[model samples]
Target: MSELTLAIDQSTQGTKILLVRQDGTIAYKITKNHQQIINPQGWISHDLTEIAANLKFLIRKALSHAGDAAIKAVTISNQRETAAAWSRRTSAPLALAIVWQDNRTTKVTEQPNIKKREKIIKYKTGLPLSPYFTASKFNWLQTYEPAVQTALSTGDLCLGTIDSWLLYLLSEGTYKTEPSNACRTQLMNIETCEWDPELCEIFGINPKNLPTIVDSDSNFGTTTLFGTLEKPIPITSILGDSQSALLAENCLHPGEIKVTFGTGSSIMMNTGQKLLRTKNGLNTSVAWKRKGKTTYALEGNVNYSGALISWLKDRLKLINDPAETDEMAQAASKNDTTFLIPAFSGMAAPYNKPELKAALVGMTPLTGRNEIVCAALDAIIYQINDIISLMCQVFTDSKLTLHVDGGMIANQYLMQRLADIVQCKVLISPIQELSGVGTSLNGMNNQTLTLSVSKTYKPCLDKIQSQNQVKIWANNIKQLTK
Candidate 1:
């Protein structure tokens, strides 16, 4: 292996490629923004052409800074649930990539054919039945897109998540996805480590179109098409962005937990091997598979976080941008009873309701933008508490420190409230790019930098009052959605 290693993290928002020395030192890093769509029907999709176009420019710039560095391996970390299908002949995507946020699959997923399939699917994949998974999205593409239907009938279509598409482009023909990526499709059996025939029969997708499932640490192939580089490096590791972040955090032991606060907020706790089914909306999934043994996790996903702050800026015009919210937050306090439960795109995890609506409760005439802003921030943390309470049942000991990362973790008010409501130490990492850099690389394996606690917020609220207020907020949100 050469002293230099290249790692690319392709997420929902953008793609970042990093050049790291064998000493775990970052030589250089470059990122490129890809175009995303909130379509006419309000479905989120990624323009595959736009992403593909941006990659060339981004990679060229990243390598130019490498100078004479000898590259060893090229690993990938990607958004797990985003789906893309293409023709094997032209190797062009048939339609826009169905982003994980897209809700187009709700109709088909609830259909009789797919409805009964959820239980069976969960049994194998360790993922609940939802439009967020690839099974439903793949069905939607086939029914709506003529190009996809043609490819399916003629056997020209190849369906895969974002990682598969990237690996195909990088390898030129070697198309396979690691266990971390494959498990998200809701088609692969976690126990067998293979795509299930019965599961494919339920979704009406051909088994032939799916990518081959491999280990996370296994060598995928060579990046031959990346021609600007001096030598083609081996495609070494492919881990799901979330799982990779978990590994990068050095959460190799079971019972270790981390929360990622991004466009959405998710809390995942590492559970070694034992796949206990979640009863209170917590989803049990494969954290990562190594040496033929799979590590399981209890995941609690909350659909809205920073996006609420984004919504206030874009829809309400209360603030000019997301950055301005922090200043506004500083002026606001919890003295008012105002509560904003943002179920904008419905709620996930503990309150998995599709018809739920966003609400701003207990508002008075004296209410201002900053007050509303405070309530909104409080509501997001309250949601996290709801999931955390449910997550606590899995672990016998209630006393645990939460490791936090993501764009939203930067909000001081949100972090404080998160600690207060959960009654736990909320440790926020300085590097918000935990998802990108954490995936496929080790932060503690050979790295000198410590995953030290950047800031720790302790609980400072009355426990009873916080619990009562949270219940009231939940009830108010229930009414709004109804």
Candidate 2:
């Protein structure tokens, strides 16, 4: 009997469930998208109940296709930094979960005291005092929502990330989170791998309200997910989606990097054991912890990437489907000098400009749908290139291996363009669902992943041409910011 494991990936956009066999092959997979829940206040949210229902549905659907495979355990990879406020007694959410991308707390971080203590906060948590983190959103809810305040006062509030919410619902009562997700809350100390008392007080979050931190691969609890399976499986692993992909790519060595393009993009480099204190906007986070041993990573986040392509299709009506952008981009004139700065939700990492709006520059008479489509694709590449530049600054080692994964990597043209602009060899992972695969692998003891490069994109442009193009883009952005 071949052993199997179920891996659930609850992301910003949707939930995916995969049944992996012992032979390192996915026996079955199911995906379901949830509502985005945007409001007039420009806050982004997810229906936690809807997400949980979808999780149960995906698990039931995958298990039906999986036959009688002997399942070993279950693991989860979820969107990091999205905070959830729930009732401890009834397990009901107090309000819509505050998404990581929501900037409602921007004014909160600008307070004199917060601005004054930025250096101290960053030094302790390895994260800046920004609205992008979970603590800020958590604080926002506690401050604005009357129900959240009441729950917090009554000690019935369970403030946590998506992973903890799912674990609590699935296991019927286990309130816990792992380091990879906990580190993004801005309340956990990266060095101690525990909730910091002073930082909790800074955010006005009580330590009792936070979930107990655990190792990445530690048992989250046992769950049947509302009897979707024959037997309860140990919830063996939980990790933030990006960090899970880092492990899935097996980027263990210092200077090894993996870029995951999804709703947003995260460019992370393994800095080994030593925490590289970066003066740049890049963030240092606990990559993972196992058996009390921890590893660290330097990460840069871009608020827009593949989401830009979605906007072009859904909002602008430029393309009927996302995949069409690839061919349109290939058809675009190479000489056209159009550049798009996708600051839809403000810029993050390296730039740190939250007030800047997006811009499309250098259009000409020949600019059309194809050129615009190409510009969107180029925007994704350039945003990723910016983060890669920052990661390279810290890891100055001559040889750097770049591993690429995500749904967007299917575009060979875009991958080639990314390689050319970044001037690095880009290796595409054959697996599209690396986050789920990584979470499943985390649960396995002494299991070695055999990852092979499906395709390699090498730099096609000369260094001078690449430099000039980047300079042009930067100049255009500077004009817009002014």
Give the number of the best model, judged by TM-score.
2
Give TM-scores for every candidate, taking all chains together and pairing residue i with residue i: 0.94, 0.97
The CA lDDT of each predicted structure is 0.77, 0.86
RMSD of 1: 2.3
Candidate 2: tens digits of C-alpha lDDT, residues 89-191: 9888888998887887888788786778888789988887888888888888899999999998898999999999988888888999988899899899888
User: Candidate 1: where are CA atoms >4 Å away?
Assistant: 23-25, 397-399, 442-449
Report the poorest 10 consecutive residues by lDDT, candidate 2: 393-402
Which lDDT tens digits does candidate 1 get at residues 287-364? 876666788877877767766777788779998977776678778755777888776666776777755666677888
Rate residue 375 of model 2 by lDDT. 94
Error of 1 at 280 (Å): 1.5
